[model samples]
Target: MTAQTGSDGPAAPEVSDRIGGRLLAMSLVLVLGTFMASLDSTIVNVGLPVLSVEFGASVTEVQWASTAYLLAVVAAAPTSGWLAERFGARRVWLAAVAVFLVGSLACALAWSTASLAAFRVLQGLGGGLLPPTGQALLARVAGKSRTGRIMSIVGVVPMLAPVLGPLAGGTLLEVADWPWLFLVNLPVGLVAMLLAAWLVPHVPAADRASRFDLRGAMLLSPGLAAVLFGLTDIGSAGRNTPIAVTALVAGAALLAAFLAHALRADRVPLVDPRLFRTPPLGAAVLALFVAAASVFGTMFLLPMYLQSGRGLSAWDAGLMLAPQGAGAVLGSLLVVKPLIDRVAPRTIVVTGFALIIAATVPLTQLAALSDGWLVAALLVRGLGTSMIASPVMTIVYTGVDPEWLPRASSVLSLVNYVGGAIGTAGLAVLLELRLTATGDVAASFSEAFWCVLGLCVLALAGALRLPKTAPSR
Candidate 1:
């Protein structure tokens, strides 16, 4: 294939003809950074209770550690493209790693809940950029023919991280102090940095004269953070609370303002809202949002059911979900390739969403007799998740111009983070409300299932709207 350059930068050096040693080495290095960055999102989950006790704080206070990180991540996502363009991808990537390492170290030494939360925000500053930046790096090299398969490999970390997080955290806590949770990233970070420095390509920076969209950034970052914050509060306090209601409305209004500004602005917006005019990119973005919602909701609820509902230990709860991880990995390895080659990408995604709905049905019933049944359901769920997630990613760039790849990545990442936050918070709120009426765990979880099922159904509808073309391969 002839190489085609984008306005922002040169195309990645071609690797399809020689995807062996050096390519593999480069991929491993990139995946290492992606995996480590993704891992931090959930690794602190099981540690929440322990940290709560250690700091003599309530669950609500300790929750900020996670919340703060999430908010920072959402805020940082839009800037990734600009940063990568202004600096070099290699330099920005290395800087992100160094920042993440420093944040992790600070988190380990945090003496109070507030201190921990502050450091988590710092950590998120780095964590937020990893996915989109890493994807762009891979996308540049993989080119059109190889994007789907390359994404399948790159997509593994985000899907697998949540599943593995609790297990790793629980295991570490068993043998060491809570600080080990953050400390653990040190070696991984060091190794990833070294590999990336040595193996990752040194792409030249784009020569665009346009500066970062500070105006758009002002509108988007705080707007998303406020909306997410409001969504999170819905779980703790009812929707009617003055704080939540005010935040939600203000956030939505701000986002609307940003959208209008982006549509008419002379300068490039943080993300071009006009991109949604493209049917494929729009459908893919919508599908990704809904899919992320379901994934995050399920990840949030399952561990709770296993630990609190089933009276299992944290370690055991994490272990119980291991089958889902296995199934997801298997799906990425086995299901994505053949289907993308033969079937419409939309069909694959719609089928995957259907499987998610099917898997979720049993959870709504919530009165299963055996662990075997639940495990099987989760296995199917994992397959469905991989099918939808990988395909949606491959399709997101369909109508997108090459110059906009970084901005596109930012948009998707922003949607992904927001969708996850809503899904997690929305489901938790539903579960809490259900339990309020009937103290029965099974009944509450059953009700919560309907909420997530609705989300998957919405995703299915979006998938149906996707364009009819297969990926470039």
Candidate 2:
């Protein structure tokens, strides 16, 4: 396996202490960019009901606003590492921010669902770069020892965004119109763009630059896109059709082709297959995928249970969900650092998954009747989720060498998104099937929760492969 290399080289000079100031500035820019990108993912969700009415579309059709953005991000993510390697990080960062700004404007001006989806694609193309580039910048700025703390802070953005999105969207929708949901990104994106230009340090390419693996990128991007598209289509189709069958078959073929192309390429492939050879790295990736799916899939189902099953309003659901986020912050602050210091990552992960299993078991007992106990169970589940996030991420980063940190982090981040996408879709499929069989939406959802719980158990199995002890700093 080609071990990860630290950002810059082993003996690269440290940024001056003045870098402290620059780091603060750069972090703000990154957080702003992330907030805008993540907000759009869930912000449009609340606006969807209103949008359906405004555009004369069904709720099902309005769902495409989120789906298209996700697919677009998946399609564009692989190219981020290459872009940073070719152009300087600053240039690529600036360009992506600009693209996001333009896309946001287009979304505001969109006259129909079709136009809005197209604009979202543009927004996603830019937003996709943020995760990978953000990690790269963080790794370059903060040395390895500090990486854990940096990532711990970075991790809070994704957790908080979903909670913040509805509040922002509701205010915007109430004060102005649904288009303002998209318009809100404009000023935030522009400020991020300017600050990034000023504060993000530029690392010039080393040794005349690596050749861009265009063919590999072409194969891999479309192949993954096809797979995600197929999965989403299955959820929409509700039954197997020739078109769906063809998409699945084609996606598999394309993915196989992508693997072959990456392996055969003379230059470093778009994705370094060598990273998977390390057992810890591979296991970390798998654990991340499953954990993300379990967590996000539950997030999707729980709110629905509260709203559709219990008849709570959006605001009440948000308020009820607050404890989960609170638990996450608490875990990050109290548990993650000490856990990493004292326990083996495998132990921490196993414990975390066990906690998740414990938390989820209570969910199976939920009924159509409102119960304070159900809300309390969800609060515990959120705590378990918080315990899992940072430690698992720390494990993934520790396995990688410093130089490859950016790429490894990027891949790991992408897998989390991919997992969430698949998990949510798969649970939706299962819920629908069970609903048909059982004639109870709540019961169907409960069965789906059990499936998610089973996946968490599987994740614990993967966590077993982590090193018995933390890697030396």
Candidate 3:
């Protein structure tokens, strides 16, 4: 990739052909890092039931295995850019890998649910850094023009994780024990650490003489944690308790405070509020938030439909979900970048959202009987998701100045997690309410699917606001 200076400063030296091997090695390391981080999100889900039985814990208690990890990821995400800028991306990335490996080991060795939850939090701390760092590295390596293709390849992991997590987890659970789920990360993370240490070029730290914004970090991290925690608590709290209401209210207030603090800070803030002034960047952020809501919301509901509505076993549900990942990979490989080059990104995003709407419309019509139509719907939805994912990110990254890359990328990552939490919580509450009112699980899931379908339509509307062409930097 060719390197050109952005308005901020001179660009880092491009990786030359002499270092092609090194570039390939670093890319592999990044992909591995991304896979390790994303795999944990879904892998633990399939093991939740086994964990409940093994620990003699209630279903609600065991669910924390997933919830705690997600909350930890949210808490740690804001620090990634600051940490990378202060310490250097290579150092922060290696530290993150080490933390992940250690946390995975602790999780494997844990004897109780509480201990496992704590360890998962450590793992989240490590995992959260991978995405932003990976994106930054790719941005540097691929340069300005090829950012879409490079990011598209990296983007496959998030889509694949839902499918691979359960497949890997189910196979491991059948063959061995639950701890192996955590144990699996050790080898992959170690390899990534080694490769990153060797192949990633060292960029000089950002003018670190500039003081870190500790106050902003404090507010953003806990505020995000509280918000996600409150949302996850809704299912257990029945959404009516004073405690739940208070947690949600406090979390929202803190987040609002964090926003105000970020906006007014004289020094560089943890998140750069000025990026939002750019029209494309602002719209891209909103589109990412809504896209995440549409995608993960369906993921949260689909497996439940397969299990409770279709009466498939956990393993079978996982097997059924595999096609979605396959379709996503296929779509990415075939259409994502080429289509973006030929058409406006806004057009691609709008088309993607429309496809999601098309695919999801069929789910509302699902019956007690299993058939090809359900599988077809999932495949099409995966295609729609893949179609939008990479292009949306490319728009976000390419829209801003290079200095703001980290901040913009971090914001997008943060929105994704928050959107996912909201989506999962909102759909779960809707499904639960419907199930309570009507005895049929299928009917409830069908109602939830339609809600998701509506969200996709909303995302399409937001996509319309995206620039018809890539903006000049």
Candidate 4:
């Protein structure tokens, strides 16, 4: 966390309107990595059905492709901040990209779902570190004052994820084999890597001897996995079995122990608990926690709904999600870019969630809604999603010191994964239970929509604590 941003790294640079061409190039280059990582999170999901058939496995088994990647991403969190600072952001980022490329090639070559999951874990480790490290590097150059606007541009990746990911996955599958899904990242990634080697500036390590927090990493990673495993146990078993209870308890205890270690540490621990002391960062972090769930859980849910509820093909469902992606892109351009730098984050976030809540109202009636109605509702939700995410991320860099930016990104990214897992897993559990108990598919999904609504309300509560206005230049 004490890592230097530059020679005058600690001095806050003024936000210049005329952001130079060099900076913009750097930003775009960094965004390439962000796009790959973010896109991977959803694109592979569209291919799960294909994987199921190819491997002669159940959907439940094939799902580990996505889950294993997510879990690996979570596993990579604690180490990402350290990696960024230890080896320098450039080397670490390139290394991550290389690893991700390797994982992608391996996944393309995988023979079974089990092999794919294993390789994905390797890929997830790299994918997990890229966004946080990339953001930290960009923030180092962009300065806190410019974070809101620049971050808004970066928001395009996530905002467009709902659009490009599924659509691209669906479209690709139409013309090629499933292996192409993983292979596609190769060219794009190589271009990013080569450009990064040439264009991205290097920030050297501040402390070579900054001992890696092996203890903290151990506690945090396993702890998160255990909790997720417990949640999954409940989802699959349909009851709170002894294994679920034990896992839940053990995971809680480990997390508590890690928190105690972080709070009382003399040297900055991995994910220092004290980082929250920075104004509004805590609130922003909390908001992102639930926001991940609300956004991603819905992303997870809607595709399934279309495929299962409407009996559409995976590619069709992916195309059907285009409206939401379109709405998000428009919102980012029209709403977020202008307002994010001027308006209060609290207001923007609240408004975003409001749109989400409104959109979700239609989703609750998925049983009978036409594609037109569903698309319209999703479009609204997409707008809300951009409003919530970009503003909160804006607060992340602006609200904290440059030295803490990497760790801040790490913590925020970590929570986003955990929160998304909780939401997605919970929805899966509920959908499974309701489908079994009621034997009414639409009704079960309709009931799950209520949970998404609840997550939105919960996130809004945190957003209320965000700074009333954008951080001044």
Candidate 5:
């Protein structure tokens, strides 16, 4: 099932066609953590206004609930690989689930907006750790042969979370209270933690991890957080404020330093700079980043467009977005994995971006589109997204040695997180400027779609650089 970049075909026998047995059981357990973490990222936005009124705070002040969690998630992501290597992926994942559970309950019991936001930080740390660590564990279990199918299982969670979050939040609010948003995580988290403890096997801690790239950590960690904070500031504060500018500059400098140090470091750095030069890995990282921006940025822009251009209620807009979830499911079931074993991942990724580009072109004519047309475009885009995420991620996991998978997952996850933030923030800023200049909402969205389309096109370029076939381990 291993495909060598140097070979004309796979170096091993065909991979299994489906997930089953204990691997399936363990995958479902990991999915619980992934679902909760990804779900909370979007779901809480639905409760922001309710929280503002409950605490008698300004909407902007209550907005910290989401912002704090986001920054916490970004900040905590870099530490996950280190933790997994030190304590084992299964242990780190279990600890993350427990921490997330406790944080969720604390969030439910929060007495003020400040408390809620603070509790969300604790929650976000766990949320940040869960996905990558769990992915490492599962990828180790599935190995090169079954990596694509594993991705189809796990990658689908985040895709569906955005579509489902608002609905879940709205339903809980209608039937219960704002606390239910956080409370919903309790049962799921508990079940996941317990099941994983009983069923998931431990990955041994690395002896090389003893070196612990303290220098790289110092530089890259804050560098990443600062960049994301700056981007978030621009989105929330609107335009390039002094804080955003300062953070961006400082973050860039720190990141540059980290890369410099990593390249020359005596020991294995936190993330090996060489990974970027490694085939399939570097290309996979770029592809995921662009895909994240296009998918998540559009996720941000569409809600506003739907509310303004189509004059749909938030609830209605959420429903319109539901097509993405359906398309994701359809693509996974009918297309992505089926061809993955039979076709080169390079072909899947290229075709995925092509679909994404074609899907995005419709949005450029925002003013002229009808509800049905928009839905179809989003559905196709979701399918394209599925096509990209599974193959691209599988390429990363399967191509690398299992010993290196933790850091690769960490690097790719960090890139994806920052890319999503950039997309959301960049679009927000561009849309604002466009609206101010044109005074036409439709025209502003059209301009923004052009940007999304441009990013997708750039991603496609990177996709083409990926090995025309998967490489052997």
Candidate 6:
């Protein structure tokens, strides 16, 4: 096969030609890095109470360990595209893994709450680069044609993180100290780095002479950080109080200014806002926002309902949620991928959202703690989520210029993170508001499920407008 430049730029003929050999190996290497990075994002939560007791800190004070990491991740995402362009994805990825490993070690060694929180910030900086860079690399290699199956593989681990994190954390705490939580990343990181170095190709970097969008970056990065921080506070506090409101408003205003700057700028900005003008890309982004809300929202709500409402243990709650991961993985491989290569993304996405709504509505009517009905609902929820996420994400890269993949990847990553935060916070607030008035666990959970169902409906509406087919390269 000959290399051909599309509306984007040079296609990855070299990598595409070797799809059965080195390309598969490199994909696995990148997937490994992404899985670890994504896992760390949620794995510390079950250990939070443990850390609180160990450090003699309160719940609110201890949360900053996770919050600081999230803020750092939001701040770091907008920079990943530029870093990949200037330095090449392979080099930047290797460095990211190394930095993550170092940060993990430092976190394990942290003696106090403040120290662990600070080290988490360090970890976040490295972790933030992994997702976007990995996506961009895979996008460049797979091009538009194969993004469906490839992203399915890359996304599977992250999708499983929420389901697996509490289980992993609880197990670790059961057997060892809190330090082991961070230390667990050590062997994984090392293996990923070695595999990446050995199997990944030296894809050439973009021209380094483009004036970096320093001013836009200044606005965008911190704006995202603020918005995410505000939302996180809302989720934790279970309210949209003064602090959350102020931060959200301020962050929204700054982001608006950045949007104006990016649209009007003569030079390329950090993320090319014009990409959103494309119909398919725009629709895909909207679907992504909704998809993220449903995924994170349900994950947040289900566990609370199981453990706090139904009085199950953390470990048991995690086990009950395990079927969601199984259904999601099965759907992605057996259903989403095949449909993507054959059917319209619009059909797949709309059907997926419909399934999500159908599955979630049953949560409102759930009566018993140990009913097999809950498991059945979760499995359908998983299938629906995989159907929506995998297809929408694959179509996102279709028709884009290859040179723009890095920035596009960054934009998607930022949106997913932000959307998940919003869903989590919004649902938590909803549940809290219901409980305050009613004090009924089942009623409050039902109210939250209604909110989730509404979000899924919005997603379905957006999916209706998606391109009828994947954009031709």
CA RMSD of each candidate after superposition: 2.8, 4.2, 3.6, 3.6, 5.4, 3.3
Best by lDDT: 5
User: Model 5: per-residue lDDT, tens digit, 43-100?
Assistant: 9887878998999997778888888888888878888888888877877888888889
User: Number of clashing residue pairs in every model?
Assistant: 0, 5, 0, 0, 3, 2
User: Where's the lowest-lDDT run of ten residues in candidate 4?
Assistant: 4-13
Residue 391, candidate 2: how far off, in angstroms?
3.3
| Cα lDDT, model 3, residue 6 | 39
Q: Tens digits of per-residue lDDT for model 2 on 92-114?
A: 66788888889889998988888
Q: Candidate 4 residues 146-244, lDDT tens each?
A: 677778778657546646788899898899999998999999999999887767766766554367777788888888777876766665533557887
Off by over 4 Å in 3: 1-25, 236-240, 368-370, 470-473
Residue-level lDDT of model 3, residues 1-473, one tens digit each, is 65544332235466532335556566667878878898888789888878999999976788888878988888888888777777766677778889989999999998889999999999999888888877776666655676776666677676677667877898898899888999989888887777776666665457643567898888888888888888887855235457657878888888788789988998888887777777877777777787788777777788778888778887788888878888888778787746655568887788777888898898887774356877887888888888776877888776666655666667877888888778888998888889889988888888888888888888888788887874222
* TM-score list, all predictions: 0.94, 0.89, 0.93, 0.91, 0.93, 0.94
Runs in model 2 with CA error above 4 Å? 1-25, 162-168, 237-241, 337-343, 368-371, 398-402, 471-473
Clashing pairs in 6: 8-401, 8-402
Rank by lDDT, highest first: 5, 6, 4, 1, 3, 2
TM-score-superior candidate, 4 or 5? 5
lDDT of every predicted structure (CA atoms): 0.81, 0.72, 0.78, 0.81, 0.83, 0.81
Model 5, residue 367: C-alpha shift (Å): 1.7
The candidate 2 region of ten consecutive residues with least summed lDDT is 3-12
- Worst lDDT 10-window in candidate 1: 3-12
RMSD score of candidate 6 (Å) = 3.3
Tens-digit per-residue lDDT, 101-162, candidate 1: 99999999999999999999999999888778877766666655666776776665677787
